[model samples]
Target: MNGADAQSPVIVVGAGLAGLTCALDLVRAGLPVRVLEAADEVGGRVRTDRRDGFLLDRGFQVFNTSYPQVKRRIELPRLRLRPFTPGVLIHTAEGGRIRFTDPTRRPSDALALLTGKQDGKPGTGPGPLALAALGPLCALDLLAPPRLLKRLPELTTREELARWRVPDRVVDGFLRPFLAGVFLEDDLDTSSRMFHLTWRSMLRGTLTLPADGMGAVPRQLAEGLPPGCVERASPVAALSAAGVTFADGSAADARAVVVATDAAAARSLVPGLPAVATRTVTTYHHAATRSPLREPTLLLDARRRILNTCVLTEVAPTYSADGRALISTSVLGTDAPGREAALREVLAELYATGTRDWERVGTTTVAGALPAMVPPWPLSRTGRTASGVYVCGDHRATGSVQGAMASGTRTARELLADLRRP
Candidate 1:
């Protein structure tokens, strides 16, 4: 390892959102910073692929516009975001569909909602009253003051739902599928705090996808940084207060080091860190001549075989070539043998269409898509590990893009404060 002066730049490992955010903040603070990423690209999990004239994200992911960090950093208009419908369409176990919409967004629908009609159509689903009843309850809980939610005792998400008086029909038919798609778990065992925060964000903002793809988010973040600030394909094998040793036998001296890798990678780099459980997800992309669902609404399965599915082309035409449709389906788990075939069969049933001609474009299986968030989880944590050595990622906060970026910002502030110390 080469020796260096104490004035060397701050080194950030892993060019994911956390690392990139940290580097950006440090640079803006007038501190020299360098970012090292193992992959050729900056986005760790947030990546887009162009295949056969289609834009496919690394996994099925969306950008929530309500994230404070995202709102502060991202240029929404520049991203050319396309929004999903205000609410979700739940395919009930009894072979009917329920379109649940946000009444606040569609005031006209509120009247229909009270009369057991959805979108001016009579409800033809299992337990229409139950579905209608869920609307007011959800709105009440979602619109509850942030201070009130914060003051409530921590509980599992399931318990929180009961406290909110959400009925079993809504829980099984709507919340189960929707939350499974978000949390990647059907049990609703995630933290109630997380659920409330996430739900509030959803109520306050729209769920959207960029016209170019999710990768555009990280690409935008990296674009604003100075040239040579980020070194791609340079992975750090070990980190210490003194500096970092790269896997390529190269070394860099830094006054401080920040490990911003994923939960598993962070643990590998820094021993004795708390172990975090992660949720896996598998997404399958298929090309169809026409969209099964013409609307841009997300569809959930009440029967619970598939987590959720959406027609990307319907939401953003840029996602697919002209005259072709792109369907993205996500399941909660890793890919298995014959999984694709099974998913195809399930999709056919869900959409009530024949899938014999639908072409399978790609399948992405992410083993550690998100860190499992249980109750009593910290919204933020001290990034300082040992003096000049620090760590930050989604694991340090909630497991979302917002959480990741927030952790990075928090780490940068902490590091800056420490640097200013005598």
Candidate 2:
């Protein structure tokens, strides 16, 4: 099964999180690896740009400290992680702005979860059903054994939530809108298993950002490898079991090839792809002279046109070079060049502050942002294809840092095991 020749390097066709992890693992196992990246820098979709004096991430991304791969690979102290309020702010016509804190973690927020006082005032809580369901729901996700959880029948997230007896209003108002941002699917059609996994992580981890930006995450991962292991601005024109031809009429021979690019790119590189369905996400970054919603909490739209918006500067002051407030908002689909005026109107309502003077710093649309995890979704799949080569990315597993790195790790382990066999 090993297609590689002796002393030939394993050529990785991307320098994304999955690629970085795979190459790093390979190098650790005493294999020569060369990472080819089409972009000028590493990180692929997980990139940051300095523009208009703002640190704008390519998409709205957060670093969860609790991811196993992240904890094992990244040095938390180096990133200087900044935490967001472990709760959400739901903005709706019905309830202007409702805050829900994780009373379990933040005892200082210190009231009943639904009945908890927010912004230092008596707040109206949820009805009896939601109040009763909330704690046990989180507890089950948090405390249940992983093997037991996975054995449950696969269902759509919405269906599973209903089975748990979450009232329809709660699903529509909060769960749907909030999860839409996370899963990049507004319908909650993602797998219940994926939903529970994420819910458990959220309960256990702190939602955070690197002081510098999300880009630092992959940069940190790549830093461990030897110098020149990763080659930037190198695009792969075609792939074969023997080697890869570059877009520039050059070729590099290899023992094996790993297609670690996104799902679309992987399809072009490796044929007969898995059942991939993805949702696109577009994030709009606006710079404002005046701060809005000064707290470092994510604002979810219950009305649900814009999935969520946050004051980036509130979480990490380094995100803004000129100290102007950086507001980032994300929508469920792609390309909204014409929606500037309307987006501003939504921001105006959400923040209760006019966005007329806010400058649009950047618009980032990540096609295939997340793999669509419909009912009966496979939590993980074999990356080895019939073609004898391999593929790895978030799409090969679930979509998250954990998923991407785990895919890379699993593929590397598989590849290494094959090589070791007599």
Candidate 3:
């Protein structure tokens, strides 16, 4: 049924972070928008599940307290936040562990490499090998300048390592592992623009989480919308100028159709969609006997396989009941293999605690979770081919929740302008 002919209203496909945000924005604008979700529940990747009175998130995710876009767009109080206690611990196999905190309090944190007693640790800090790599890696912040990325396409991880007069030892020991945690990619093959964006954000905010798991953000977005505005478990098979056809042969019409799903799903719905790049992030959640670390730190393991380990409970105690905690290990390269044996091998390499009789609480590997925010990442496809067709998602903006929300708001703003254009 055409939107002008249907009994309902504007229909948005996929009630993920972007879709929900867009729908809420449109509804608040009094556009009478409706959201359609493929899953039974809301929150595409940002999901929270309750088990044995403990709240569990689908994947290991964190939010930057400095996310300017999301912070300005949403009323964060709705999703109780748990801020990290101003520091991160890097647990290493050979070098031992060190804590890096906010530079404001410990101004020495920023000069740790030059200062011999940085963060109260031994040596000049981060070791000579790691320090050597920091030179070019730190220079990446320069790319954040206005439009600098256009001229520095060749300034990628590989390029920076090769050009910076740094040694191969520094690249291997420091740059590789450090960049892995930031980009979640084993290699530096990603675009230099993404590298700069990550660096800028690093300079921008503190790392934090919602008390109710990462899912709370999406939940808040969904609840903000009008009742009966979102239809769950209805996937859009194809979309045309007339309207959308669901997998069950049901159709819904709208004056404007927004594709707020993942890149692959958008390709299926919109023919000849822009080329998209994808990356996988593997999260290992452990229900341990005791809390691993009291404070949250981005663990950079020398093993190369385990990118980072985040103690979620310490970051946000509300995620688990008192006396119980949740720890997550994110593997950057590939999705955890389906074969139990391979998974066990990877886990053993990650936690150094071999996969054994310890019961696992929950584990997830997001195959299409992260976008390759590298160079050539596509621009916003909002206000695409048709007058009433729109697109919004992380794939259309930066790959973070902030990016997704920004895309949605921009779409709504543009839509409103289009309505008033006449």
lDDT per residue for candidate 1 within 228-304, as digits (tens), equals: 99999998888754698889777778978889998888888887788889999999999999789999989989889
lDDT of each: 0.85, 0.86, 0.68
lDDT of 1 at 408: 96
Candidates in order, TM-scores: namely: 0.93, 0.96, 0.83
Query: Highest lDDT: which candidate?
Result: 2
Candidate 2 vs. true structure, TM-score: 0.96
Single out the weakest 10-residue window by summed lDDT for candidate 1.
Answer: 110-119
Compute the lDDT for candidate 3: 0.68
Clashes of 3: 3
Report the C-alpha lDDT of model 3 over 41-103, residue by residue, as the tens digit.
Answer: 898877878876567676667777666667766677776777765555444445444454545
**lDDT tens per residue, model 2, 123-157:** 44565567567677888988997666777778899
